[model samples]
Target chain A: MTSSDALAGHTFEELSDYLDRDRTPADPSIEGSPECQTALNGMQRLRSVHRDLLLKDAQRESEREDSWVSSILQHISLEARAGRDIPISHSSPTARLSVTEGAVRGILRAAGDSVPNIIVGRCHLDGDVTEPGAPITVRVDATVLEGEIIASLADQLREALYAALRQHTELAVEAIDITIRDLYQPFVPPAKASSDE
Target chain B: MSDAPSPDPVSTDPGTSSTLPDRLDKVVLAVPGVDELYSAAPLVAAVVKTVIATTVEAVTGEQKSNSSVSVDEKKAGLEIAVKIGVNAPYTAIDVSRRVHDAITDQLEQNGNPDVAEIAVSVARID
Candidate 1:
């Protein structure tokens, strides 16, 4: 893609750096661009939870695969754009209300992340999200922390996603399909492991 | 007192008060669920405008108000557009509707006649 297409003309690296700086000196270019702002929001959420997710594995940082993080970052960049305007009906003829597709995806990610032991990797809206009352199926890719029952976690995530979507938009949601792509085990202390064994 | 009555003093100058767009911005942010206000203008246009404004401010020492809310005067009425982020636990759609109603109320209170449309979109839901 050309220069203009990259996260509202700012690279993901630049965004990460900006966040690293705690958004000090307030760069108007990034702040003014909605796409950059959206991505930044996602990045901030991920960063906030990163420590908690890895607290048990602090000593095994090197063993953690960077691929999942890359995958989620890629998805964030793609989904942080204003793709389509899904209308919100208002009784007044003059009032036109709606939510952006990018915003919907943000909620999906948040909902999935809310579930314990699950991190949303990528999200997709499979159907005409722009069309009102269209049959839409939400497909989400996730990575779950090992030791949690996969089936139970998936069910909990599905319910959370459904609730978030129903609350935020008027889309006719047919189903929520969740895929657990990877499972990573947290580092357990030797003493704890021996005691459990 | 003199027999001649003093003419009615002007209560307040509309020009001195905050502009309609500014007022609407405040109103939207004041809504319980709104977390952020994003530029409603398209990305390309917003970038160009920011560049120009930044340059102009640096050279001329004059600050320009870069309001996220877009207002247009039309034959039918005024058209207002805005994009906002809704804080969690507050439904995005509900927040958007509240913002829409808030804008309409602001215009009505200001004695502005008719609203062509008020498009409020939730750009981010935290």
Candidate 2:
């Protein structure tokens, strides 16, 4: 069979074997020669470009400098201005339902998961500590949480906070309190936006 | 104008002190491609500022910072220049692309874009 015919329906390995073993057809022609060379070159170029694109994507992801913190803060401020009391709870000595900056941050970090583009704001937890298993409320100021994802975030934060508090201190892990104070629309700044646009 | 000692300016002046560097550090760290943003001497900052300024002008339609870059014979690699400009965008893609294009173009034009794998990052302003 001709080289092109032989290459047809053959995998790369088969082609490589045919080429490497010098197994040319009985009637040799330029088709057998340059065709193999061209195919091999194409494969190599494809691999190189594939690798470069992957690297470039990763590099682009890493070089990004947008801030989730500011977005979270903005959301929180907006919510506060709207007269909605952002939910928050602490299992400390004082058990109340107000937000604190630190608690807000803790909830956010826990909820962020591996998702990119999510930013958490400073948490404010109000409530009594020293009470184990107290129903601690939770709140978050985030830019991107939708549908069931918000519930998932709440669950994740509850678990994470319980574990973190227990792991770090001897405080009895009480109930988790969750409150989403503000939500922000994800924004990629104008300069970067223009490039992608 | 009545001189009131300027009230010694509240500590929150984004300018004045070393705030820009701190801010840049936060910004740079937030970005993905930036390994780190180091504070350099005045001379180094000047060179970096120039490089950045020239780069932005060449690549982006707008000029954001007055920074530049210079090679440190002693240090071997390029030294970062400073003259913090807060107006510069903090996003990594915006800064990196402009810097990358400028550096690449300059290097290619000068016959060496391949050799200078310089990564430019605008981490902080101070």
Candidate 3:
């Protein structure tokens, strides 16, 4: 490609390399004028716009109210409550416990309660608990469980499942399996301290 | 005790009345992240409050309000906050960072800090 056209794709450093090596066209045409310095200016403008967009995005993120988180949790909980039953195939197992991703998220949210930065991942029930007398094992993947929070989450899940089971049927929970999949990093808001003049 | 007569001070200075508010508006508008400069009424009132407070403090040499700034992101795009008595020196950077941080914190806390653009303004006491 021609030098000017090549510049459109190449960064300032690359273009500088071409100029330093005298590979740029020697013609005095406006397209190839040495007096017309344009590459870095365009890059600077582009960089400014990118940074502005980031700042704007950050501002938008900080201004959202609590309702958003609440709504997301509510939606997940609703989905979990309406658990679907996947058909048991062949002779592998007769009991089936199928839960939607939404329900799992909801259960996790319920378990998390007011805990911040808690995220739920893959969830599976180990044992068959679909029948009235069958024992069940609930396996959950979670992040951001520290110290007693894990135990607290487990307790919260037990209560949630117990209530859910009581409402749906009379199946008793044999064991609650909680696997700590991930940990969440707590986000701290920037401090606005007044600088003394 | 010369209590015979007191000349009435000029209460109608057109230049002061006309230019002061416009200057205040310009100063407020000059602060970065201030979008739709005309649409900020509550913020304008807050600025006026700050200006008056600052002026009173300057006259009496007494601290009237704390130097802290409070941000409230309600209806003005994504993030919004008000700085009552911002100190000098790092006024520009402080205001900019405070607005940015307020918006960022609120969005991060609420779980969607990457969707919208936020605007902020500062209100300084006189």
Best by DockQ: 1
Number of clashes recorded per candidate:
0, 54, 19
| TM-score for each model | 0.82, 0.24, 0.27
How high a TM-score does candidate 1 get?
0.82
Instruction: Tell me the lDDT of candidate 2.
Output: 0.36
Tens-place lDDT per residue, model 2, A69-154, is: 32332333222211122222232221122222222232234334333333344444344333434444444444344333776665
Worst 10 residues of 3 chain B by lDDT: B117-126
Task: Flag regions of model 3 displaced more than 4 Å.
Answer: A1-83, A86-119, A145-149, A193-197, B1-126
Per residue, candidate 1 scores C-alpha lDDT tens digits across B11-35 of: 2225554566667778999998998
How would you encode candidate 2's per-residue C-alpha lDDT over B54-108 as one tens digit per residue? 8888898664433123223223322223211112123322434434344434433
In candidate 3, how many Å is residue B65 off? Answer: 66
Question: Of the candidates numbered 1 and 3, which has the greater lDDT value?
Answer: 1
DockQ of each: 0.60, 0.01, 0.01
Please report how far candidate 1 places residue B87 from its true position, in Å: 1.5
Ranking by TM-score: 1, 3, 2
Superior candidate under TM-score, 2 versus 3:
3
lDDT of 1 by residue, A127-166 (tens): 9988888899999999988888999999999999999988
Considering only chain A, what is the TM-score of each predicted structure? 0.84, 0.33, 0.39
Q: Judging by TM-score against the true structure, name the best candidate.
A: 1
